[model samples]
Target chain A: MGLNTRIEAAISNAVKVGQAKFPDNSGAVPPRLASALAYATAPGGARIRPTILTSVAMACGDDKPMLADAAASALELIHCASLVHDDLPCFDDADTRRGKPTVHLAYSEPLAVLTGDSLIVLAFEILARQSSHAPDRVAQMIVTLAQRTGMPGGICAGQGWESEAQIDLSAYHQAKTGALFIAATQMGAIAAGQEAEPWFELGARIGEAFQVADDLRDALYDADTLGKPAGQDDLHGRPNAVTLLGVQGAIQRLKDILGGAISSIPSCPGEAQLAEMVRMYAERLTPVVSPQSVPGE
Target chain B: MGLNTRIEAAISNAVKVGQAKFPDNSGAVPPRLASALAYATAPGGARIRPTILTSVAMACGDDKPMLADAAASALELIHCASLVHDDLPCFDDADTRRGKPTVHLAYSEPLAVLTGDSLIVLAFEILARQSSHAPDRVAQMIVTLAQRTGMPGGICAGQGWESEAQIDLSAYHQAKTGALFIAATQMGAIAAGQEAEPWFELGARIGEAFQVADDLRDALYDADTLGKPAGQDDLHGRPNAVTLLGVQGAIQRLKDILGGAISSIPSCPGEAQLAEMVRMYAERLTPVVSPQSVPGE
Candidate 1:
């Protein structure tokens, strides 16, 4: 099968694993909370982050299903947790996500909060218990995950930076978006018993490129095509590449960053495929001549 | 200092460490979210868990300020995160905590959710970066903390059980309260390069005793003395020991558990002080002349 098809299958399998690992939703206390967790984690998206993780793992000469699954699953859990919290009434107050009502909107605010918390803790648990890598490697992954999810340069810091300081657009994007992406790549490499510094840098650049593309999409694409709310940055008064560098400038910078990311990957078994996927992702970000004919379409 | 005075000082120091660690309360794009996090975490209640953690650490023969402070701070952060989620409208819907309005009540629900999420991540960050122990020990601590905070046997499962299963009082108390207590003792011993199994059992028993005492306090004490609203368990229809075992039976159980806990500690260099502290705590649990005679009182 092609790389795209393989990635899709991997994501589907990861989602199944994530869902199966959750508390049974049919129980008595209230199915809503578990349902919300299931709902938020189901209906899988592009699974770009997990794909990057697994791809990097493959590039490092480790195709072991267990290692790939653990790394991908851990990244997905973090992504899902971030989404749940991001949609809370305090953050985006999002009513819809991935064409369905967000967790909080579908359930109650408390359930959403708990579901998010559960997911965060579950991410670490999965990594600690399931990884086939050495204990030290797993420990490194856990520490990296925690650091990226917490303060200074993690998601929490990324989220908090918006309120506390006058941050540069690049720095903001790096923290908010690049941190997790960096984690995904590094974790993948670590899972395969490879040093992660080079891959970490590559992932960070790709993440920045992706964020730029996302900023452009938010400004130029419709909600139907994006699968969620669009034009929210302006609505929330958040600064983005679109605001800092303008449309054309942001697109140019995105292409440059993507190229840099692809070039940064060391020549390995799956390097060609990894580089091609990055190119395809970049191309997918461009405006289509036919509105419905996006590349991922 | 007396054991009580020392415990109180340890708690205070832990609170200071936690607060200092996350001093910045500003968000990157939305300042309100950062403010919400600060408000939620800053004015916390008595840092009882941290005290327990440091006490255990000290009892294990590692009394370094740095190690004790790191463990204490991390535990408090986890507790704070749990409280934030618990008080959300969908969970407990509590408006006040420790005499102040809860995070959701003070800020918007979305911000409260994000704040809680941030704190959870921060807890792991503190452990990963600040623990003054070997890397493997740090990893073990992280695993232990994550397991207790996550599902199945952790606080997550405890909360989930509240919604779905008719949990036995012992199981409920074990997961919800005892897990963290076990973690505190384990972390303490781990910090001292000591075995954790015996301390883990001791802490778990002490935690069970503490929970029973708390239930009694809720059933028999007044709100003014408790600080927060009383009879919350009854309001929520939670099956407490007081309800299932009866007040006198529960009180007797508390004493027995405390006695077992004190006896469980293996004789060590600091065994006497640890035993003394346990005795003082057990004595405090006896039917007091006034509710204000409780530890926090």
Candidate 2:
């Protein structure tokens, strides 16, 4: 099956697991909590992180397909949870995400908070359950996910940076965006019984590229095109590549990062295919104008 | 070292780990976030859950004290994080916990949320890192913690029940208080290389007993004695044994459950010692005024 199809199926299955496990024998789950979880994850955007993970696993010759799928699903769930929390009123206060109302907007703020917490737990739960066949891999993946998601240097720290009086752009961006990407690459390699250390550079570069792309999109696009609120970084007084480096320089930086990302793919049997995947992502990251959207046509 | 001392030491060490890992090269960790994580856990009350966990591990013949400590610390961290979130404005809106300002009041609402989140992730990270000697055990503990902390039947579900229009007292008590107790027992057993199944009933009984005791305290004790707000269940219009069964009946129920808990310890080499420990807990749960505070004195 195609990678995207596999990811879609995996995600759907994971959400089903979440749904089935959410309700009790009487079929009672806080409807809002259940729905928020599904809404945050369903009809996912791009699936870039999971796709990168799967590509890494495939390049490393994935022998444990189930584990690979679980890793992908788990990473995506974490991403979804982050988005849910990020859109909270205290955070970005975003009303929409992925072209739909954010979890906090669709549900109450408290449920949104609980949903985010539950999703993070669910992500680790999925990984732990899937790694039963490979105990060591599961343990490593748990550590990787937790470290990237929590503190010391995780997404939590990334968010916490916003509360600080000062911010370090590199550290902020790395934890905010790069941590999960690192987890994806590392978890993919671990799932495939490959050394994870070698893939960090590739994941970091890709993450940097993605962040730069996000900055450009936020600065250049409107909410209609982005499917979410744009100009968020500037509004929040948060750090961003575009604001720091200017639009053209940010776009140039993104290209350079993507180039580095492609070159950084660790030596593996499927190196060429992985490089191609990176190239495809690079193309998508570049802004394109459709003919029908031309104002003077 | 004595068990209490060991638990105190372990908790302190875990906080140190949290503090040490929170900062970057700049030695900055959003000071409030770091302090919140530390403060929420310090001067802990009772340490009952960790005590039970360690007791179970010892009864099961734990050889890896480090892993046992890690497991115990992990469960405690989850409990602490839950307390932090539970006291948030949208939830209980508690102003104090354990006789001090709660995380939200002491820090800020957003920081409290992030602190709770970072601690949960930190729990799993501690377990994963310390369980290097037993990968299988670590995997089991991770799954166990996630299950108890997250959805369907976890603490999150328990909290979710509060948001529902209807409430199930049994399910509510089980998840809100019982879940962590069950995790403590099961994780202890897993850490000791024993089957966790035998310990579930014991944990559940203990959990139910603890909940009943809490209900009794909430219904009867003053804020000064309880070190927090009293009659919270009534104040929040939540389900509780005291309200359902009356204070006397709740006390009676607490006694009955304590008896059941004593009789429920799974057979092991240290069965007698474990029984003694349960009995000690039972005595404590029965409640008594200090000798200096006798009414007729």
Candidate 3:
């Protein structure tokens, strides 16, 4: 199967596991929680992080299909959970995500909170269930995921930064957006029986590039086009690359990071394939003028 | 060391691991997040869950100190996380917990949410990091923790039940309170290389008894004596044993369950000791009148 198809299947399977685990013979949970969890994960976009992870695992000469799929699903679940929490009234107060009403809007705030908490736990459960081949590797995968998702410097810490009077943009963005991307790359290598350290820099670079691209989108696009609110950083008075460096400067930075990412791919049989994937992602990250932005004819 | 001292040390160590994992020089998270996490976990109440877990492990002949300590700490962290979320405006909307302002009240709503999220993830991370003796055991511990904390009937599901139109009292109490207690017993057995299934009944019975005790306290005690807002169940219009069974009936039920709990101890080397512990807990559960309650008399 193609990478996208495989990624899709892995996510579906993970969702099934999450849903099935609840509402067993015991008094089942109110169906809303289960449905909300499925809703947050379904109809996913791009599957970019998992794609990067699966590709890295394949490149690393580790063909443990179940393990790779589990790792990819686990990381995606964490990403989805972060989004669910990030949209709450306490955080971004976003009404829409992926062009639909946010989970907190569709469900009550309490359920939304529970849904996010459930998903995070489900991610670790999926990995533990799938990592029978290499228990040690599974242990490492769990730690890597927990570190990226929790604090003192995980995604939670990233969100915590927004509440502070002073901000460090690099640290903020890294934990906020880059930690999961790093987890994706490192976990892929770990799943493939490879040392995780060599791939760390590559993941960091790619994550930085993605954040820069996101900044460009947030500044230049409208909510309708982005499928979520744009100009959120500005709306919240939080820092962003575009605010620090104008649109042109941000675009230039994106290019430099993506270029660095391609060069930093750790040597492996799939090094060329990984570079090709990075190049493809870089192309997508490059912004083009929408019809709305064109100068008056 | 005595069980109380050992339990205290175990919690401290786990908190250290959780805090250190964050702020890894990538511009540390805003210090507030770290302090909030520590603050939520410190000056713990009772340490009942971890103490139960440690005692069970000791009874089961699992002398691996680190593994046992890690399991105990992981369960307590999960319990603590639940309290943090339960106190949020979206849930209980309480102002005080464990004799201090609730986390959201102390920090902010967003931080409370993140603090809960961070602690849940930290629980699993502690187990994975500390359970190097037996990888499979670590995997089991992770699954046990997640199952009790998340869905198809974890603590999250328990919270989810509150949002539903009709609630099953048994299932609600089981998931909301019993799940972690079950986890404590099962994980302690797992930590000691024993099968987790045998201890399920014992944990569930103990959990039911504890919940009953909680209902008694909630109905009978005032806020100052309870150290939290009393009559929360009534205020929220949520289900509770006291509401369903009445004060006298609930007290009778509490006694019956504690009696059953003593009888339910699975046959093991620790069987007698476990019974004695349960008997002692039963005495504690049997409450006495406080000075504040003398007004009516």
Candidate 4:
């Protein structure tokens, strides 16, 4: 199956398992919450993180596809859960994501909070269920997911940076954006019975490139074109690559990062194919905007 | 060491591990979010959940003390995280808990949200780290923690019931109150290399009894005595045992449930000691106030 299909299937299966009726079939996941899990995830955006994970796994010779698949689902779920929480009133309060109402907008704030919380819990649970296939791998993946989802270096830490009075741009970007991408690559290796350390650079480069690209899009494109609110960093007085590095500089940095990402791929059976995939992503990622079209330029 | 001491140490260690500086140690966790995690868990209330977990683990011959400690920390962290979210402006909006300001009240709402998210992630990470000690057991504990923390039958589902137009009281109480207690017993058993099925009854009964007792306390105790708002369930128009069954009826039900709890202790090496612990808990849990003390009685 295709990568998106695989990710979609795995994610759907996880929600099914989580929302399944009880032993006595008392009820099904309190209905709305069960549905909300699906609601928050469907029509997935780009499926980029899991795609990177699977690509790295294949590059490393995915000996256990099941473990790799679980890792893919796990990584994606953490990403999705972070988005849900990031859009909450306490945070971004974003009403639209990928052109659809945010989870909190579609569901109430309470359910949205629970939805995010449930998804985070379910992400770990999904990996744990695969322990029968490879207990050690599952354990490591759980750790990776948790590390990339939480503290000093995870997405939450990324979000936490916005609240800080003095933000460390590198640490903030690393935790916020690079952490999961790093998880994607490292977990992919770990799941495929490969070492995790070598994959770090590849993930970090790709993650940094994506963040820069995102800043570029937000800076250059209008809401209708980007499909979500643009110039949000400026609007919120938040830091961004475009703000730190002038537009041209940020674009140049994006190019440099993406170029480095390809070369950073550790030696693997499918290394060539992984590099090609990265190239394809780099093409798709960089916004196709003209200098004349740049807003306020 | 005493159970309380063990629980306290385990919880403290887990937070310390989560907040520890990274390798090469450039920057620590977003200081505010890290501190909020510690702030939210300290001066803990009864700590009934983790206490029950450790007690059960001991009862079943905790051959792996480290695993049991991790499980206790994981379960309590989930409980603490839930309380932080539960007190958010969107949910219960509780200003104070156990006489102190709630996490959100003390920290900003955004920090509170990230703090809760971080704690939840940390809970699973705690269990996953135990994988090196006992991979299979750690995996099971992760699954157990996720199941009790999330959808279908977890605390999240319990909270979901309140949002529904038609509530299922038994299911509500089971998910909201009993889920973690069930997790405590089952995880304790899993940690000790015992089957999880047999311990469910003891946990459910204890949890049910606690919910009912909580209702009684809310009804009988004043704000000064409770150290938090009194009559919150009634004030919120929430469903409670006392409301469902008259005060006397609920009190009787509490007694019956606690009695069943003691009897339900799974046969194990520490069975007698476990029973004594339950009996002691029963005494501490039951409100000592009389009918006259119950306002509007």
Candidate 5:
């Protein structure tokens, strides 16, 4: 199957596992919650993190496709869960996400919290279900996932940065956006039986590039174009590449980061292909950069 | 170590795991979040769930003591996480837990949300960290934790019920309170490499007894006695055994349930001792009960 198809199928299967009854025949949850789980995930967008995970696994020889699928789904679920919680009234209070109403906006705030929580638990369950097959790899996968999802260096830490008065730009960006990318790459390698260490720089670079691209988009596009609140960094007086580096400088920074990401690919059978994939992501990431704007691809 | 010591240490170890740096040298999370996580769990009241887990594991011969500790810690973390989230303004809106300011009140709503989210993640991470030692047991532990903490029949579902106009008392109690009890018994067994199915009834009966005991306490005791708010069920117009059965009937129900809990202990190496523990728990659960209130104890 194609990468996208596989990732989508795996995530769907994981969600079903959660929606299904526990093995001991416990009671079913409320319908609204089950549906909220679906609503929080459906109409999927770029599927960026899982795609990176799948790509990294394939690059690492893809010894265990099932493990890769489970890891990918688990990573995406964490990403999705973070978004659900971040959009709460206490945080971003975002009205929409992925161009639709945020989980809290669509469902009540309580369901939103529970939904985020259920998704987090469901992610671990997805990994555990695959454990017996590859105990060592699954164990590592679980640890890698947990590391990237929580503190002291996970996305939860990223959200916590928002509430603080003095923000460390690099730390904030790393936790907020880079942590999951680190998870995506590291988990992909671990899923395919590779050491997570070597892939760290590649994931970090890609994450930095993505964050820069996001900043540029938020700066350049209107809310109609961005599909959510735009100029949020300026509005909140938050740090961003566009503010510090200027438009041209930030775009150049994005290019430089992507270039670093491609070069940072560790040796593998599919190393060349992975580099090509990173290139393609760069193009997708910088779609607004015209031929003259970037000077060269 | 005593069961209480083991549980407290394991929980402290688990929280430390969340606070410490990831192995890959990522940025450290904010201190406030780390502090909030600690604040949410300390001065813990009862330590009831972990104690039950420790007892059950001991009853099952706890071949892997560390695994038992991890499971106990993981279960308690989820319970603590639920309390942190449930105290948010969107939910119970309480200001205190365990006789102190709630995590949200002390740490801000955003941190409380992140603290709960981090605690949930940390719980899985704790189980995952133990996977290398006993992959099979830890895998089952992870799944059991997930099953008892999330939907379709976990505490998240229990919370979800409040959002619904119609409440199913059995399902609500099972998900909200019984889920973790089920996890305690089942995980204790799973930690010792025993089958999870046999312990389900014991956990369920114990959970029901505890719920009834809780209802009786909430009805009979005042806010000072309960520590947090009292009569919350009545305040929120939520369902409870006291409302359905009256105080005497509820007390009687608690006695019947605890008696059933004692009888439901699955045959194990420490079956007699486990039964004694349950009997001891009954006294603790119904402290206000006079000798005449529960005859032939």
Candidate 6:
């Protein structure tokens, strides 16, 4: 199947798994919290991370849908948790997400906070419960995820850094965005029972490339196309690669990073497919117009 | 050493472990986030749950402090995460906790939310890192922790239930307050290589008794003594055993439940000190005043 078709299927599967895991009225939660959780997890997004995870797993010759399901759900949970916290009044103070009111805006702030907390817990729970992977592999995956989600080098630290330090743009983006992307790739390989160390460098490079693309999008894309507010990073004085390097410089850097990511894929059995997928993603990010392009046009 | 001293020492050890595990300014995290996390996890609370866990583990004949550390930290993290969420404007809307400004009140709400999320993830991370335990046991512990933290039977579900449904007071207390208590007992036993099922009933009964004591304290104790807002639960109109059974009936029920909890301890080797500890706790809760004593007077 084409990469887009595979991505669509993966997104649908992720939604299905999330729905199956979190029903509308899971006995202990009040209807409102459950509804909010379901709402937050349901609407399909780009599913880029899950697609990368599944594709890597597939490229490693492991086609178990269950691994994809677990990894996808875990990634989504992390993403959702980040979004919930980011939209709180203290952070971005966003009112909407994916065209709907954000968790804190839709639910009460307390529920929103708890919802994020629960989702983070649930991500580990999903990884822990995946019977297909070895217990040790699962444990390692959980640790990697937790490390990426916690105080140092995790999304939390990424957000917290904005308030105090004059952070390096690369480090900021790597922690806030690239860490999870790297994790998604590594976890997929781990689930496939492959020696993931060989792929770790490639994953990190790809993740950085993806972050640069995201930076470019934030600097240039419209909110309507991105499905959320754009250019807010520059407005909030948060460090970004685009800000450090002008638009053209950032785009060139993205290309160089993408090349490095693609080139780093080892000559494994299914490396060709993985390389192609990486190339496609790079091309897709190349043509997206920046918001600066039409200023006052 | 006396059981109390032993338990206290165990808790101190667990605190050291937790502190050492979550270091300040780990290169992985941005400096600000690291400082915030260190601040959030700084040692100050009573550490009652960890003490209970270590005491139970020792009582069950597992004297290894390291084994208990993971479980202890996990429990505390869950507790800390809950407290952070509880204090947000959407829930109790409290400004203080443990005689200090709540996390949200101290940091921005988003930071508080992310801090809480990090704690939840960290809890699982600790469990996953305990290489000393059998993989199955560790996985089981993670599952139990997740179930108690997630929807349906966790504190999150308990809090969510408050928004809708006139939930039964017993069920509400069991999910919200009792689940962790049960986890503490079960984890302690598991750490000792003992079966956890036998202790589940006992721990749950003890948790219920403790909740009853909490109700009494909330109704009768002043804010200065309780270290939290007095009678806030009643003000919120949430169901409580005290509200349902009345002061006299609740006290009687508390006594009965305490007795049951003490009796439920198995007649096994190495249980004498644990039994004595249970007896002391039950005796401590015996009613001092008649029903004529006004609540919150």
- Index of the highest-TM-score prediction: 4
Off by over 4 Å in 5: A23-27, A287-297, B287-297
Q: If the candidates were sorted by their lDDT against the true structure, best first, what order would they fall in? A: 4, 5, 3, 2, 6, 1
Tell me the interface RMSD of model 2, in angstroms. 2.4
State the C-alpha lDDT per candidate: 0.70, 0.83, 0.86, 0.88, 0.87, 0.71
For each candidate, give the interface RMSD after superposing the true interface residues on Cα.
5.8, 2.4, 1.9, 1.4, 1.7, 4.1
Off by over 4 Å in 3: A21-27, A290-297, B21-24, B289-297
Docking class of 3: medium
Give lDDT: candidate 5, residue B245: 84
Q: Write the per-residue lDDT of candidate 6 for residues A51-103, one digit (tens) a residue.
A: 78777888887656566567667876788778887887777888778887888
- After superposing candidate 4, which stretches have Cα over 4 Å from the reference? none
Q: Kindly report the interface RMSD of candidate 1, rounded to 1 decimal.
A: 5.8
Question: Where does candidate 3 chain B have its weakest 10-residue lDDT segment?
Answer: B288-297
Worst 10 residues of 4 chain B by lDDT: B20-29
The TM-score that candidate 4 achieves is: 0.98
Steric collisions counted per model: 17, 0, 4, 0, 0, 7
Best model number under lDDT: 4
Local accuracy of candidate 2 as per-residue lDDT tens digits, B158-263 = 8877777877666667777888999999999999999988889889899999888887778678889888898798898877776678666776888888788878
Candidate 3 lDDT tens digits, B127-204: 999646888888998998888999878999888988888887677888988999899999999898888888888789
For model 2, residues A1-297, the per-residue Cα lDDT tens digits are 999999989887876666564332344455556677788898899999999999999999999988889889989998988888888887788988999888877877878888888888888888888756888887788888887787767888788778788786677788889889999999999989998889989988888898988987887789988989988988988778876786767778989999998888889999999999999989999766454432233
lDDT for B181 in candidate 6 is 78
Q: Over the stretch A134-168, how does candidate 4's per-residue lDDT look in tens digits?
A: 88888989988888889867898888878889888
* Backbone-clash count (model 2): 0
TM-score of chain A by itself in each prediction: 0.87, 0.94, 0.95, 0.97, 0.95, 0.86
Residue-level lDDT of model 1, residues A95-153, one tens digit each, is 77888888877866656666778778767666656433466677677767876676555
How high is each candidate's TM-score? 0.81, 0.93, 0.96, 0.98, 0.96, 0.89
Tell me the docking grade of candidate 2. medium
**Better model by lDDT, 1 or 2?**
2
Q: Which stretches of model 2 miss by more than 4 angstroms?
A: A21-31, A289-297, B21-28, B288-297
| lDDT (tens digit, per residue) of candidate 1 on B1-297 | 643455445445433322343222232333555456567665556556766677777777774545555666677778877888788777778877787878877775655666777777766656655433465566567677776776545676567667654454555667778878887888778766677676778878878887888888888777777766788999998878878787778878999998899889877788888888779778877665354534333
Q: Rank the candidates by TM-score, best first.
A: 4, 3, 5, 2, 6, 1
